[model samples]
Target chain A: MESPVDIQDLEIRLLLETMLHRYGYDFRNYTHASLKRRLLQCLAVCNITHISEAIPKIIHDRAFLDQLIYAMSVTVTECFRDPPFYRLLRERVIPLLATYPFINIWHAGCATGEEVYSMAILLQEEGLYNRVRIFATDINGKSLHQAKEGIYTIQNMEEYAQNYQESGGKASLPNYYHSKYDLARMHSSLKENIIFAAHNLATDNVFSETHLVMCRNVLIYFDQTLKNRALRLFDESLVHGGFLCLGTKESLSFSEISDRFTPVSQDLRIFQKKRGIR
Target chain B: MKSPHQRRAIVIGCSAGGLQALRTLLPELPPTYPLPILVVQHIPANSTGLHTTLLNHFCQLPILEANDKDPIRPGWVHFAPAGYHLLVEPNETIALSIDPKVNHSRPSIDLLFESAADVYQKGLIGVLLTGASQDGAQGLLKILHRGGITLVQDPKTAEAPLMPRFAIAIGAATKTLSLKEIGHTLKQLGADTRE
Candidate 1:
């Protein structure tokens, strides 16, 4: 007999296969270690004892599958996450983006919409907001709906304020939002130019040609093959001299597409597409 | 008990006041130490990677901050970078994640320990050191349940005792040793494996 862990992993593989065949949500290509942990976590939350037990429910019940997919997707995010990267953008990158006649910016895997809105706030301060149209996309429809509303807890303001100031905001953070009871609602001006939609990086092709793409902290969960596929998608869409931003923990050094982009800020995980390359 | 020759990797976890202990422990292992070491040390999300640089500056082994899909190799040490959960794959590679933090820490000790346990099973050795939180306890217990050796810093010797105390409370530790003794034990294992 196989050990329990071996059986569990095998069951996880079967579950992933069922999800893909039944729903077309391809988790089969995700990094194994995290995929396993997430499935186990979802299993516990669903009150199921074993991973295989959920496979049948997931196949027969649409609501159950959606709930499982929501849990399985990694969506950890914060407003103005990684203040220094924002500082680098607000100080340096956005200015170059300002030079463009009209820019298209894509925030891929923009869970809950915090960082995408943060970008709009900075652009408004820079007087670059009106010229730029931002497309914030994610794989989860539930997260997309929340992102569209542009509302977050008032309790987050203190941390958001600190991060905004450190991201080098000259105006007070309150200038960007209105508080009602317990919610912080972003000003309508920031929302007007942003179009929130559902886009799957794994299966979907490029949405449009873009000036900049910010997919921070999303690609680290993917295996190398999946990451390369997404990078290739970005490569096809990014205009020459456009930019790509990633989290500090990620790098292009080992990627197949690294040759086409040079480091704008290696420390900040920003890369500028080579003017000579496509 | 499995001999030193049978173990494939070593995992160490710690939090508050762990730097002092790591400084003492990691620096003493000889350059020829034969097993890969994976470490999860709690740090702020916005850390500048200075500590990893400082530790690599003096340690006999080549110490580097882990990157995504990095191969796990012997005689080198990989520390989980700030703001990512480091995991070991059955393919003998390291994977990083920004998954929700466990125990309020991004590079959570429990995630590292549990993931490593899944990959290495009875071939793994997990160590818990000084920490203020109860993060590593469950992971240590997991390693124990997988038939791997669970070594923890004796709470009496730990700078902040809650972490190891929790592990011992759960009956997780196979042995609890002082920092010096743990260091010596690892070095002895390395020597025995080399021969």
Candidate 2:
């Protein structure tokens, strides 16, 4: 007899397939344990026990699936997560990038736009803001909306402030946001060169060519195969010698395309696409 | 399937202000402790270097950010690279899986603890330390259910207390100690000494 755990695993696989086929959102390649936890959470929230029961409900209810997507999507992010990584960019990468007349920077999986703002601030400090266009994308609509609004809970400001200072901010962190009631609304000027949109790394194709791509803390949720696929997309999208920065735990070391990109800062998980990798 | 007394490995989960806590805890452990120590610290995917550098500075034990399919070994501290869940196989080897994020984290404490519980069962000791979220509670419970020792940091002494508090409230922890005491206690428990 198959164990209940095995049965549930199979059911989850079926549900993922059904969801992919029906809604066109591809979660087919996410890590299994995380996917299972997400599905279980969705089932619990929907007040159902079995995938059989939840699948039907989710199939007919677009809103329900949207909730499920939000639950499943990896959205946790902060401004200048690795301060030194940003510091490195400012100290090393930006000067070279400044030589270009126009720069297109992509912030993949830009949850709530904190990193986008951080990047915008960095660009502004480097005098590259006017020459740059940043495309910030995430699959979560709610987070995307929040990103567009440029607001955050006041509770987060202290940490963001610390991060900003560590990231070598040229100005006071508080200077970027205005306090109203209990929330801190970020300055509108930071969004001047930014465009926020909903784009799925799993299902969406490349939208633009760029000088740099920051997809930090986002790829670790994907299985190795999906990671390769995403990296391939990034590889194709980046211009020659364009930079790709990932979370510290993430690396391009094992990818099939590892040779196509050379390490900019191996410890910081920063890479630069080779000049002639077609 | 061995009894708790016969267990051979320890897994720890921590997050949110964990760097300083880990610096305090891990450095006290001797270089030659007897069992392997695996850790899951909730951090951004691109930030493994910070943990790697910090641990290297404090612990005499060899510490490396885990890679996919890396084998678990004694005398080393393996941290789940940011953005990936680290799991232990039944054979005591390490595996990386890229599922969705759990408990709002990728390198989730719960994911590591639960998988360790499955693989090591009574032979595991699970530790929950300072963190902001409730990620490790369910996994610690699984460890307890499987007859593993579950240690939680005393909330009052933790940098971030929500995680330890949650584990205590849920009855997931076998013991709760101050960070300093936990470090000494872990030393006695045999961390990464056996070559």
Candidate 3:
């Protein structure tokens, strides 16, 4: 007899397939280990004993499905979470971007807009904000709405302030946002050039001629096939000599699109789109 | 007890004073230690490459931070990256997850040990070390139930004894030894397969 754990694995696969075929949300390409953990968490939240038991409710109930989507994708983020990554962007990439007449940055899988605002703050400090348009996208609509609002928990500001200083911020981080009622609303100026949209890296088309594509911490959730698909999309979207930045733990060394870009900072996982496809 | 040759992997879980424990324990494993050592040390999400870098100084075997889909290689210590759960696939490859934290830790000991138990089954060796929480108790129990060997640090010697004490309370540990003894036991358990 198969173990309960093995049965759970099978149920997870079937549920992922159902979510894809029924709802057109292709979590089928997500990393199986993470997906299974997230789905199990979803099952527990719904008070369901098994993944198979939750499939009917997921298919029939929109609210439950929405909750599942939010829970499945790791939406937990903070403004300027990785200080050094932003420091690298400030020191290396922004100078090249400044030379361009107009700059477009895609914050792909931009969960809750922390890094989007981080990028805006960087550009503003560098006196480059007017020429930049940031496209912040994620598959979760709720996260996108939150991102659009540009408001965050005030409790996070202290740490963000620390991160901003560590990332070579010219001025204080608190200068960028106002605190009221336990929330920090970013200054209106930061939102002027940001476009928040719902775009799935697994199935969506590329945003054209982007100067920098920042998809950090997001690719770790994808299986190899989907990772390559997203990398290809980023490659297609980036202009010649544009930048591609990923999370600290993520790398393109083993990526299918490896040759299409060269590492600008191997330690930071920052790469520049090569002038020619290899 | 299975022979050294039969063992596939060593899954270790530690928290609290884990870094100090690993610094002392990892150096004792011989240079040719044959099984891949997978570790989950509870750390803050923002912590960077410092853990592996610090441990590498004392380790003869190469110590690396575990990345998604990395193939398990013998004679290397793979630390679970902060902010992600590290799992073992049936193929024995390392997989990572951004799933919700368990026991208030992202790279939860229970997640790693349980997944590894599922993958390696009878070929696994689970070790629970110094920790402040009960994170690895259920995982150690799972490993024990799956016919794998499970060890725990002797609660008397641990900096934070609750984790090992809990595992012992649940009868998850087959042997409970001091940190030094645990190191010696690992060397003996892995002696036959040395390259």
Candidate 4:
């Protein structure tokens, strides 16, 4: 006899399929362990009990469907999240990026934009911000909206300050933003070269080739197949010798595009696209 | 030979002085211990992973930090990394997630316990040790409900009593023993608890 949990897993698969077929929002390839937890959490938020019940709501309620996507994909990220990564990018990758008269940095799955702003601050310090255009995109429209607004809770700013310093900031992180009561609004200048848009890693294809692609902490949620698909997207979008930075735990080992890139800092999850696949 | 409990995997959770608690707790298993042991010990997000190094100094089995997508190897102890929750996928591969923290801790014990329970079911053995927070109790209950062996450190023997204390109060533990007994129990776990 199948146990309760196994049945629930079946229900989750059905719900994911319904969402995929109905609205074209694909949670179909999200890694099961994390997706199950988030789905359960979403169920709790909707005050629903079983995973099967979510299918009806998913099919009929358009607003609730967006809410589900927003809730499930709101990956908790911090500014300069992995300090060592930003530090590595600044010390190693930025020098290479500076060679291009105009550069594009794609923040795939940019979420709420903390990391995008972190990169903006880094480029501004490196004197590359003016020449750089950052394409910060996520599948969640709500997150893209927030990324454009660039306002975050002041309570979070302190921890971000520490991360900024640890990421080897040239100036105090607070200088990049102005605090208004409980919220900190990023300076208008930081947004000048940023374009926040909806780009689904599951379905979206690249248009412009990028110099540096920062999709850190995003691919861990995907199964191996979807992960490779996204990695291929990044690989195709990146120019020759461009950099690809993944989540600290993420690796290109055994990936379809594994041979196309060489580790710039394997421990920091930074890689350089080889000039040519030999 | 049929193992007594049919145990397939082991999971442990601890926090606050867990280093010392685990140091004394791990040396009980002999070198050829049969099942993979995954642990969740609450540490700083920036932890340098000193506990694995220290525990390996005395542990008969290898103690290493769990990495994403790694297969569960028998006789190895995989410690959850600092900033992410460690889960065993149904396929028995280690899957790490940056999802919201449960019980205000990223590497939450309950998250590991429940997921391990879901995967291992009655074949799982879960140990709840010293911890300041009440994270692992609900998970321990899930393990017990799934027919797995659940052991909690005797609160009097724990460095921080609240975690195990909470587990015991909820009738989660099948055995409440001192740290030494918890170790010895784990060492000989499958010898007796047959279905």
Candidate 5:
């Protein structure tokens, strides 16, 4: 008899294979250990007894699969998260972008649009919002829909306010949103230039000519191969001298494409795409 | 009961007073310790890696903030980074998760313990230490069910005993020892394994 661990490995492989063959979504490249946890979490949430049982439900039921997809995808995000990174962006990155007549930014794997709105707020304050367009994308359509809505719980505002102040915001964070009852809705002004779309980083084509790509907390979930693939896409997508910001926990030091970008703020994990010297 | 020499890995979980306890406990595991140690200590999502830095200062063994695809090796300690769940793969490599938090913590004790249990099975030794919440209870139970050795910090010695108390209530711990005793136990285990 196979050990429980081996059995789980088999089940997860089958589930990923089924997902790829049946739905055209390839999660096979995702880090295995995390994927197993997610599959098990999905199994528990769907009230399925086991992975083998969940696979058929996922294959046959579109609605259930959507729920499963949302659960599996990394969608947790907050406004001005890691305030220092935003501060670095405001201090160094934004000034360079201000020189451009038109700015194009991509917030890859933008979960629920917090970072999207946060970026808009920064550009607006910098007097550059009118000249910028942002493409905020995630693999999960449900998250895209939520990002488009721009609504979050009111309780999160206090934390966001603190983060905003720490990120060097000159105005109160409340100035960017309207709150009623238990929910806070971002002002429509912030949403004007943002195009929310469902784009899978794993399978999508390069988003060309982007000046900056902020994919914080997303790459840490991928295996080295998938991370390299994504980094290559970023390298291809970025304009020369463009910026890339990653989560504090992530690093380019181990990546095959590390040479394509040089450290702008090594501590903050911000990098500038090397201009022809690379 | 199996000798400490039989264990393949050591997994530990704590939350509320984890940092201080780690400072006291980590230094006790000699540089020549033979088993890999994986730790899950709850911290804010925006943690600045200070915990690992502080722990590294006191530890003789190399201490690292766990990152994706990192290999798990003996005589080194790995702490789960903030805002991510850390897991041990069957191949003895590290895996990090941005999956939703468990027990209100991203580097959840349960996820770490459970995954380590799956990977190491009976070869694992799990320790539940001081914590305000009961995050490690179910994971310790899973480790126990897998025939792994389970140790909980003696509630009397724990700064916040709810976590170990719960593990004890669930009949998860094979032995309950004070912080000093736990360190001594681990040191003896390390020496035994080397022999």
Candidate 6:
């Protein structure tokens, strides 16, 4: 007789496979503990316990899967999560990026677009806004819509202000947003250079040549094989000697392509692809 | 159920200043090392190649970036690629998770350590090396709580002291040594494979 644990494992695998075939968002490769947690959460909300009990309802119910995606995709991002990294970018990256006639910046997994606006504001301060084309992408359509709206709760502005100041703001942080009804609508000009769209790093191929790719706090959810695939795409997408900025907790040390890149600020998790050497 | 001999596996985590540190540390492991070496080096989604190429040059053992569902094997170095947290199952299978970033890192040392503690218990050996952040401290503590052995690079000699210092401050480390000492200790421990 098969043990209960074995049965549960099989059921979970089946549930994941069904989700993949029906929804096309693959969770098969995600770590088991996290996936199990999310699945349990989904079951609780739906008022069920077993995978078999939840499977039929999820397969027939589009709303149920959307809810699950929302649960799975809830990333904790606040404005300027690591302020010093941005500060270093303003000081180090901008000077070199400025030399280019026109520049393309790719913000991968740009959830809700706070970082995109942050980058835009920085570029504007450096007089590089007009010549820069920013591509901001996320897998969530809802987040993309919110990013395009360019509006945020004023409650968030306080933290944003602190982050902006720490990231070496040349002017008042409030200058970039119009405040009304405790909501801050960012300056319309910041969106002019940015193209926000849905792009899944898990499955999407490279879309454009980029001079700088800022993919922060996104890769930690991926398995190693997926990470390698994504890195290869990023490598192909970047122009020779392009800049790649990762989150402070992240590094390029174990990557297969570490030799192709050189650390700009190893402490800040900033790297520049080797020029003329690759 | 304490076995007659320790059923050992190696877990390593690195971040800021890690590439140079890894370049130094990974090269020191011989290909014939009998135990599996698992690593979590925080990186973006686009950098797994660095792990593979570096280990290929230095280690005689086969080195490969990990894949979801890959089984853990001795004499191989497996790295958590970019975005995922790599965990060890009770059966010693590699499980990948997209859990929200713990300790603000996806390839977080905490995730690896905590999971290994649950799965390998006293059989696990956790190593915290050069990094700029405090991600590994709590995880290493979990490992120690589960009776696993833990090691940290001596902060003074670490490329970045924040991570090692945090581990030491929390009293999670069993030994704090320089990279040279760490390499030598791993060689000895890894040589004692049961299978």
Best-matching candidate per TM-score: 1
Candidate 1 Cα errors over 4 Å, as ranges? B1-3
What value does DockQ give for candidate 5? 0.63
User: RMSD, model 1, all Cα superposed?
Assistant: 1.5
Q: CA RMSD for every model?
A: 1.5, 5.9, 2.2, 2.1, 2.0, 9.2
Pairs of colliding residues, candidate 5:
none
Candidate 4 local lDDT, B1-195, one digit each (tens): 436757898999999878888889888888878788999999889987888888889888999987677789888999899999998888888888888788988898998999899999889999999989999999999999998889999999888999999999999999999989988887777335423
- Give the clashing residue pairs of candidate 3, or none: none
Residue range B1-195, candidate 6, lDDT tens digits: 545257578899989888777677777777677778898988875463676786677667787777655779987888887767788865577766555677788877887887777667678889999899999898899878877788899999987899999999989999999888888888767655543
Fraction of the reference Cα-Cα interface contacts (below 8 Å) that each candidate reproduces: 0.74, 0.00, 0.32, 0.56, 0.68, 0.12
Candidate 1 chain B has its poorest 10 consecutive residues by lDDT at B1-10
Off by over 4 Å in 5: B1-6
Give the Cα error of residue A150 in candidate 5, in Å.
Answer: 1.0
Instruction: DockQ each candidate and list the results.
Output: 0.75, 0.14, 0.51, 0.67, 0.63, 0.10
For the predicted complex of model 6, DockQ is 0.10
- TM-score of candidate 3 relative to the true fold: 0.94
Give the TM-score of chain A, superposed on the true chain A, for all candidates in the order listed. 0.98, 0.97, 0.97, 0.97, 0.97, 0.92
Model 4: how far is B9 from its true place, Å? 0.7
Error of 2 at B123 (Å): 7.8
When sorted by TM-score, best at the front, the candidate numbers are 1, 4, 5, 3, 2, 6
Candidate 2 — number of clashing residue pairs?
A: 14
Q: In terms of DockQ, which candidate is strongest?
A: 1
Q: lDDT per residue, candidate 3, B121-153, as tens digits?
A: 888899999999989999999999988989899
- Candidates in order have lDDT scores of 0.90, 0.83, 0.88, 0.89, 0.88, 0.80
